[model samples]
Target chain A: MASKVVGVREFDSLIPLLRDRGYDVIGPTVDEGTIVLDHVATSADLPIGWTDHHDKGTYSLDKRADEAYFGYAVGPRTFKRWLYPPRQTILTIEHAETGLVFKPEPTADERYAFVGVRACEIAAMEIQDRVFAHDAFADPHYVERRARSLIVGVNCAVAGETCFCDSMGTGPECTAGYDLVITEVVSGERHEFIVESGTDEGETILTELDGRPTTPADRKEVRTIIEDTAASMTRTMPKDETYSLLTENLEHPIWDSIAERCLNCTNCTLVCPTCFCSTMEDMTDLDGRAVRKRRWDSCFNREFTFLHGHAVRFTTKSRYRQWMTHKLAYWYDQFGTSGCVGCGRCITWCPAKIDITEEIAHLAEQTREEVAT
Target chain B: MTTTVTRRPTVAVWKFASCDGCQLTILDCEDEFLSIVGAIDIAYFPEATRAERGGPYDLSIVEGSITTVHDAERIHDIRAKSKALITIGACATAGGIQALKNWADVDEFAKIVYAHPEYIRSLSTSTPISDHVTVDFELRGCPISKHQLIDVIDAFVHGRKPNTPTHTVCVECKLRGTTCVMVAHDTPCMGPITQAGCGALCPAFNRGCYGCFGPSESPNIEALREAWHEIGVDDPHLVQALRTFNAYAPEFKEASETYA
Candidate 1:
């Protein structure tokens, strides 16, 4: 069935209704240096017309087009924070003269309605589901939290310089993962969001809100607008070729050239929504009684690979190789999926300003010609 | 004293030749601290509390690299005693970042991350637990994922193999709807060659990967090296990347050498 549209005036009333439905209403609210996703009681808290520009360790509030809610591509944080979480209390430990005790981290929490979710973010959530929900040992915590989420996807009109969603075949337009998809249309009277019910939860919420049945003409217009947005992508990705080329050029001179410029800060991993590697810590109290905690870890840290007082990837060159190979080549064998989302967060956040797409594109053209010759 | 509920599982977090990060991860379960203590026996973890309780443990999480004549022997003792032995982190599973030292001058690496290279007792290469012992299960990652840790524990408690994927990071990138960093930014990324245990953190963080988790079930390092260079990553950089956490991993070691 075709999706309908909700007028701008009526969308405001739906917030309280969502709350009444027992959902912890989460929306974009500008905080600290970035417009982070948090709870919003009213629509007034939305960053209307305010956009964001982010670089490595740098974020700024930028001007936007006429009070838009989903103006930015993405920020430092991802949905993984709530669903997968950085550090979880998997089990508790206490030491007694007899032995040790274990307590599982609880699974119950309030249902969350994540509003203004980017298409890329929703895709990230789905990937995590496969990791946490599949097979013999599922992470109960992630499963439960994910079960309680209501996704609201926002289509992007402005592709950030770092973004390359078009290449990954994921975004510019949110295809799935959202219960509801919203596209802000340029209307004379009001800046309207063309809403479509992607799931039952979205239907229930849409039913509560005042929405006019979308006309075939209106839907067609929406398509054109969205397609135009997709075509306007500032970044591009060269696919299929990356796999073949990267796998063949072990002796290429490019790796060393880039390594000299890499600081090995690990900013790229930190900003990536899919990068889930973390370090664990076991801290015991002074009494040697109650031992507590685990935290986020990065491979960039030299200690990450220490074995018997020796470190691997000791050279900046080695560290760079491990990272790039894993992303483009090894990950293919592990997950049956490419690790690069083309989100471009790494490009924007990289202290070195290294562009993965540019490099891959160059390889795509060069290697194809070389192979052909 | 409160009545003890359920049979306390003997939890032993082990280390091979690693920076102790993986074991530290067990200790770092800050949120699950008291609860973890309540759950397992924690027979031995030198990094956590210097406790040396000998055990026929229910579950043994082995970390670090398998280096040295002594460590190579100690792991045998550990595997023999433990009921269920689970190797955690890259060091335990794939020899770790220190394994990079496998190819290079071990003497030089000892001087790099440590103050006393002279006192360092070590081998040239760092190797994974699977290399030396029969690991019932292996958790991939340079430092392992906190969420995956919980999954592994729960699986062990329930008597099941943990569900770690042996796919490429590309699957994750697609699932996340993230544009390929390599495609979009023309940046060189390693999502293709690495494993999925890391949740594709490098892409999320706006950088390329460093293969902290080690290689997937079967990776084509040679192919990836070529791809990297084609993507503008030079030979020297490719060699360095392969020499990271899982450097001594046979596939990665050989690939890196090809470049060198």
Candidate 2:
């Protein structure tokens, strides 16, 4: 793939190009004091010159010192919400003269051109793709949505405090799984983006846009910015022994201590780009018309583990253990890769400020202590 | 017109001593209300309909708290008449905000509020429907969520168990993709201890969970108190936090009493 240096003004051209190709351009915009993904028709809709300050349970928006469109980290909303909706009507059943007739809800086949996708998020989407698409029985809705969407990746120039993509080896710079990747580069007074295409569709779109041929100086600046982002990350997880440590210490006392602080709110799982638990519901109108829908469900819910008439994971400790272990350990067995992308959305959005990395580290320390004694 | 038809399942919405918010939630489901009415017979709902039909009802949704002796006896009567009795809202499930009186003297409260104490026929403590009668299920919330209420009715009509989550509000906050107000702002949120429902409304507005849905299944109230303490929350505030809409709930009550 060849890189092209496009002025910030020319970058706006991609939106119209995507829309011209019948794509709904989804990008980050400021809403309710936070950055949220919404439909963007032009460059004005993007959160330009705005960054976010994120910490444990804290997120606030601020004016960026530089006018960078992709300055902020991933926000609360994920692309998964669009691909796999919170509540979707799977089947609608109506009582006919013959009997009850079941009809699957029509799938929306609109092409979504997702802009400002961070590298860690792209990893998250791939994890979800495995869960929804690669399985024995692929979810038809997820399959259709995944197929129709075009990913426009944004390489991070600055890392948030909670970001630990370096440790997870996902990225501050996206290597693959994107149609086109954009790196926002700001010089003394001028701002531009170095665009690279990963696919033919992306290459065609880039050609349509007015961009200057990339110079060696532009490529050097892009490398420096990506490296700086990688160096700026403060949080990291122990990659080698996280799975083993967590699985081995399921009955550890630390879980009980963690549970005490954990509200069992399922915020971490819900915000997680990979968590894909859902519950089926049969909704009926008074007119004998029924709709069977699937809504997002969390393992933190007591009823999530309900068996027959009894709840299997009755305690908060058990539920928390199940969630963390499933994400770090069991997910590997199921998906052939770690479930987490180290996006740090879970830590940032946790009301309790429970850090997954800290927990894993605690479990590792406990394991060492047990062996020593 | 000549043929006999099978009767629809009769559902009666009853109120005891509440703000009538929960019952209003049913009416608030305007889009679904017509659909709900088509599936079941609304035998007695004072909020929506004036018609009073005698029960032996298939299902009964009881709201409000037993603040008066008459309400206590009335709930038992409702239980006897209904095949399945489901309590809606915090008052019916955990005595509600009125249960704050459980900590104070009712006699003093009555005298303070009423001109003549002799006219009052209220009980000393506001209690839930389960305290007076055998409740088949308790749909927990300050004012029960309309969707969950629909789920209860739908489940009963289909002869299956309702799929109401017994998880905390944290799950909903996560699903809605709301930033954690407590974590970001050091706000004391009850979301971790509060039951899931209301779709994490407060947090969505950049506020903390007020525990409107009551205590979740197996809440670690002591642990939550300790965490709050670490965050510099005092004993009085902790007690006050626990005594909200679902304060009288067993899990919250025990935690509040320790601080009280």
Candidate 3:
């Protein structure tokens, strides 16, 4: 696919084009103090020239010195909330003369064009795709939603303090899994975007837009910006021995130390873009009509691992260990990839400010000490 | 030809020594309350209806804490007559804000609050219902969310375990996609140690979670205190955080005492 350069002023044209192609364009918009994903009608809705300062258990939005769209990192919310909603009704039942009549709720196949998606988020979506659509039994609702959705990826110009995507090898640049990829360029007095088509749909959308062919200099500038982002990231994960490091140290003392600070709040899993655990609920009306719904569940919850009459992971230590290990180690065996995308929503949102990268690094240090001894 | 008659399960709502916030939550379920009433017999709900029915009740939903000697005895009788006794709100489950008295002298509290200390009657400590009698289940919250309350009623009525979550407020915040106040703003939120029920209300509004739902299952309070300390949260503030609504809960009580 060929790349094209579009002026920042002309970027608004893509909204109407996406809407014309029967897509409800959803993009990042500032809600309250943070940027949240919502329906975008114009280019003005995007958080232009705005950046956010984020740390472990901290985030603050600020105005940028230059005008650049998609300036911030990922927020507390993820694209999964759109594809697989927090609460969804699966089956409805009614009392009949014989017994009960069951009716499966029809899936709403709304075509969504997700704008301003980050590289780490794209990786997170792929992880979820494997979990829901490519699993042993595919979830029909998730499959329908995934099939109808169109991803418009945005390369990160500035990484948050908590971001470790470079080490995770998942981000700072949107490489694949997107229909269209965008990289914003902010030179003195001029702001533009270097856009690339990753799919036929993206190519068709590009043809509708008023954009010029990109020069070699323009492509080189985009490359430089992505390289700078990757270089600026301070956080990193122990990629090589992460699986064995975690699995082997199931009974490590570090687990106990981290467990003490872990509220077993399940905040990490909840904010995690790739965490896909869910639980079923049966609700009945006064008229004896019942609906079976599914809501997002977390492993940190004792009820999540309930078997027979007792909880399996009864302690906070066990639950925290389970979540971390599942994300960094066990996930490789299950999905052939690590669960974490290094977006760091968990670190930012955790009340205790527990950093996963720090935990992984600590474990790696322990491994080094053991090897040295 | 055969004729069949089915009787609705009898439910009784009881209160102890705390605010009627939990009972108000039941009334707040306006649309669903009608449906719930249609399915169950409201045998005794002093807050809603005056028509009282005697038990052996099929289900008893108890609110508030056992602060008075009389309340302490009354819960045992209620437990004996009810098939299933479910404690709702932090009061009935952990002891509520009044449990702050657990750290101080109850006699001194009576002297300060009451004009005539002789007229006042209260136990040394406000205790959860389970401390006195067996609780079939417990729904933790400052004032329990109505949706969860409905789940408990529906589940008990259907002879099944209620699907109320035993997770922390973090899970709810994640589900709602609310920004983390603690992480983003350096605000100390109790979402991690707190139980899930209030839908992560405080955090959603850019405030820290006060742990209104009490401690989650196996909460590591010592570690949380240490973490908070590292974040510059002083010992007094940490103690005050744990000594809030669910102060008498074993986990919070022990954690608070460490700081005290």
Best by TM-score: 3
Tens digit of per-residue lDDT, candidate 3, span B197-220: 888898888888998888887677
Interface RMSD of each: 12.8, 4.1, 3.7
| TM-score of candidate 1 to 2 decimals | 0.58
What is the Cα-based lDDT of residue A115 in candidate 3? 97
* Deviation from native of the Cα of residue A260 in model 3, angstroms: 2.6
- What share of the reference contacts survives in each candidate? 0.00, 0.56, 0.70
Global lDDT for candidate 3?
A: 0.85
lDDT of 1 at B118: 84
Write the residue-wise lDDT of candidate 3 on A214-318 in tens digits. Answer: 998988888899999999999998776789999999998998888777777677777789998899988765556678999999888888888998899888788
The pairs that clash in candidate 3 are A57-B183, A58-B183, A58-B184, A59-B184, A260-B223
Question: By DockQ thresholds, what CAPRI class is model 1?
Answer: incorrect
Across B192-243, the per-residue lDDT of candidate 1 in tens digits comes to 6677777777877667777777665445555455555555788898877777
Query: Which predicted model would earn the best DockQ?
Result: 3
- Ranking of models by TM-score: 3, 2, 1
True contacts kept of 2: 0.56
